[model samples]
Target: MKILVAGATGKTGIRLVKRLAAGGHTPVALVRKSSDTSSLPDQTQLRVGDLADLPAGVCDGCDVVIFAAGSGGDTGADMTDKIDRDGAMALIDQAAESGVARFVMLSSVGADDPDSKSDLAHYLQAKHDADEYLKASGLTYAIVRPVSLTDDDGTGDVILGRDVDPHAKAARGDVARVLADAVSSDDWGGKTRLMQTA
Candidate 1:
């Protein structure tokens, strides 16, 4: 399978890239020029550009596009909107245009609950909006909403379903692996899975 790995520099993103390659799939690392690409698996192909700068046929021959890019920090909600909301939406449109068969979005767990009024509500809202867009995009898609991320090791066993469990926090590596598996899972096709620990 040809896979597009957006935000390939992030913690989970890098793991996903490596895991995808090791799984015998070709992963195209999509990253902005400013992102550090050294940590990515050497076998991964790179597409260097911002989310808004995707070229025509950028995702050509790619079976799946995994959106792992995110903007979170002291940069405020506007940046979140630009990268998380608009950027994600833009990628979805491009993937659709490129005829990519599947899209797997790495969204947050709280994204679906409209009543979620956390300090990072903007981030959640952005993911929510993106999730809806993917659902309506008329394409095969899977949205994986994982809870508070930990840098802990992956066990290769995870619970994946409709919402993140309140009592669990997920390891970043585990999430990445799950997303990769989702791309290949017939049961996960066109499904939005929320993942957390058992």
Candidate 2:
């Protein structure tokens, strides 16, 4: 299967691309013109496109689309909306139109209720809107809402559910494995799970 990864240059996304390649699946990195592709594996395919303004046929010939993009903590709310919400929604629309099999989202723990008080409320709200849009888009989807992410190595063990500890942290490598598994297997279809390091 050809899996299109929207954030293929990020910490987690890069790991996912590697995992998919190891699993014998083609990993298509959806990148921008200025993205650094040096770290990607040799066999990883590239598709130049921006989530902010996706071109037609960006998702063409892909079996699965995984959205792992983010606006980062340094950016303002406007940038957050542009990437987290609008950009994700646009990709979801494109994936559906292109007949992609499933859409996997890497969301935050607070996205279920974005109105909750927090410094990241605005960002969560953006994620929440995009999540809701994916759910109602009539496409097969899987939403993995991980807790705080860390740079630690993957343990290959995780705790997943709707009621995970909010204070727990998730390793970026572990999250990447989960996302890769979601696309390579059939178990995660139509389900949303909150995950943390076990």
The candidate that wins on lDDT is 2
Candidate 2 residue 75 C-alpha distance from true site, Å: 0.3
lDDT of 1 by residue, 51-115 (tens): 75566666777889999988856777878888888888888988998898899999988788745
lDDT of each: 0.84, 0.93
Which residue pairs show collisions in model 1?
161-194
Worst 10 residues of 2 by lDDT: 180-189
Q: Residue 82 in model 1: shift from native, Å?
A: 0.9
TM-score of 1: 0.94
Which is the leading candidate under TM-score?
A: 2
lDDT of 2 by residue, 1-198 (tens): 999999999999999899999999998999999999999999999999988888999999999999999998899999999999999999999999999999999999989987667889999999999999999999999999999999987799998995579899999999998998888467799988999988
Write down the TM-score of every candidate: 0.94, 0.97
| Alpha-carbon shift of residue 122 in model 1 (angstroms) | 1.0
